[model samples]
Target: MAMERANLLNMAKLSIKGLIESALSFGRTLDSDYPPLQQFFVVMEHCLKHGLKVKKSFLGFNKSLWGPLELVEKLCPEAAEISASVRDLPGLKTPLGRARAWLRLALMQKRLADYLRLLITRKDLLSDFYENSALMLEEEGAVIVGLLVGLNVIDANLCVKGEDLDSQLTQGDVSVERDTYKQSRQGLDEMYNEVRRQLKEECQLRQDVENELVVQVSMKQEMELAMKLLEKDIHEKQDTLIGLRQQLDEVKAINVEMYQKMQVQTHTHRHIIQQLEMDLKIEREWRQTLQNDLHRERDSVAQLSTEALQINGLKKEFHRLQDENVQLKTICEDQEKALEELGSKLSESKLKIEDIKEANKALQGGQVWLKDKEATHCKLCEKEFSISRRKHHCRNCGEIFCNSCSDNELPLPASPKPVRVCDTCHALLLQRCSSNPT
Candidate 1:
């Protein structure tokens, strides 16, 4: 589980990093090709490459080139105004727009190429100038190829003619053959077709990358959700444990009280048994005294009848004392039986307490807090939290929500008083109370 979580986190980090790098790289490319509406051209290229819908403002050459053409717009405001009509031209969003942008880019490249060729033709009049112009032309051609390559419009290797031209120009070629120009043009057309092919391939690749990222993100979310559920389960179990601990303490107190009562009952029973023994001892002494008195009376001549009657009464009294002793024995037996039942009940209570302890032990281990407990958005309304819109947690469900969604304070079975809850829980609680009426 730990390894899986780590892998998921790593994948997310890499994905985010890749997106940041791509954006930064694109920004750098635009910055390097600044001045003379380079950024505008680049933006168009980017939109075309990604097949992205261009902003309506982008259709206007002046508006789209606002940064680079700022001076022109300010000095030649009328010209700028007239050029704003160019914005009504097609954009990359439609086929016509895309064709327009492509045509314009192609025309600009062709014009630059022609001017470079003219400079090459006038090499005799400008020897050193010729070399510099040729260099400039080579650089420009390379830049054009780079633009197409960056936009996935052409292959990196398709700039062979640009390299060959740079090599020939470096060797100080005074003249160029018509066949060489044709070859260069052929190379440019091949590069164009390659650009189209690469663009098509890039489109498919972009879709695949988007789908893969989406799937990965979705899987990450599912894993996170599973983790949250596990954590919630753990917290609930911990709460149950806490409750059981409280109950166990209460049971222990009750058991102590019951044990004290049992002790007192046993002590009382012992005192009663001692009193019965003392009574039996005194009765034995009285019977002995009665027997002596009967003997003395029998020794006297005329009191024989009285002594005999007294002897009979003594016997009857002795028999009655024996019956009382038997009744006391029966009462002691009943008391012992009661004590046995009380002991059994105490044992049962102990057993119950042990069972409760075992249950508490069973609930000993689980995580109470989620790893991503502070959600980015409200669970109920699905609104993202901002500086003014703070996240709030529902006390009952432990889910995050906006204040408006979880504003109600309601009583729950788990709480001692009314506490904050979400709308659904509040309604459910109300319905339950109404149904049960207790």
Candidate 2:
């Protein structure tokens, strides 16, 4: 029971170590900078520490030493008897007590295998610590395997010796340690070498994996930088395009403004041309009227000079008659009276001629006024004729009007003098007269 308990404790210890080593190995396989891998390592470390404590507590338990005794008895009661007999044998107590230790060793082996499997299943156990531990585990496994093999050989020999003892009641005739020990030693050396070689190969593989990961990380960084540069370039190009578009818009606006100014100038030029043509026509008409007035004035001046000459001749004849009267004044009294009456009559005739000349001058002034009125009427007619329709021309006042305002019969107010009624005024007067009975 003690042997079995020791074996169980050793198995638990190995199992815990193997689990920790496997977890560490998984951690190394992940990206070294991965935060989750770090967290996993922390959990593994905690679990390992807990396992160690459990192992220690288990080893300290009194029941743990004898826990497997019942199981052994159930499997083989003869084994218990053999154990007792070995304990009583001279110089064989220690060997027999230790013989059952194989059970613990086997358990340790299974635990180690389980621990390795745990490491293999995990995704983050590729650290240097894990690799080194794995190598150590491999070496340890080889040693454990050798021990197990020797134990198996020893158990077989014990089985044969027990059979002999049962048959012949003899206990000193069976011997198998020499050949078993030789075979175990040879197997241990070969396994050790193989374990060392495997360790070296695993180290090389781990290094290669780490290098590949680093190269991949660097390539990813370079790709990110390139993308950033491309994005920046695209943004710059967009800005340039926007600037150019704005410039194009400005140019278009300038062109539109220029086109509008040109149109306005064209309109102004046309208006000025029409205005100038109208002014030229008005100036020509004014010049022709002025020429006609000058000719009339010249004719009137010549007529006045001729009339003055004829009046001078008449005055000379009157003076000569008066001198003849004075010569005959002493000749006869009746003749003197006649001469005086003649002289008085001559003075009266001269005064009448002067009145006639004044009357003619007033008549000429009235004729000029009438001519001016006629000219104004003609100008009004021309103005009406220039329009599309013939407008009304007031015969009494010479005022122009449209066709609708040409009613001439209606009289204006008496206080205002002559009534020059348009169509509206004529209608208003008729309306008022109809309303008033008188």
Which runs of model 2 end up more than 4 angstroms from their true locations?
1-67, 71-175, 223-438
Superposition error at 192 for model 2 (Å): 2.8
User: Each prediction's TM-score against the native?
Assistant: 0.17, 0.20
Model 2 lDDT per residue over 1-438, tens place: 333333333343343343345546554332323332222222222222221111234336211212222233334443454335434544322221233332222232333233333333432332322333332223333333333232121111112122222232122211222322343345556667997999999999889989998998999899899999989999999999999999999999999999999999999999999999999999989878777766765675687578678878878987998888787665677677777878977788677656644643453353312233233223322433322234455433445664445645643332235555555445655675566433
lDDT of 1 by residue, 259-371 (tens): 99999999999999999999999999988877776665555534657778999999999999999999989998989978887896788767765664454344333313222
On the 0 to 100 scale, the lDDT of residue 324 in model 1 is 97
Give me the candidate number with maximum TM-score: 2
Candidate 2, run of 10 with poorest lDDT: 151-160
Total backbone clashes of candidate 1, pairs 3 or more residues apart or in separate chains: 4
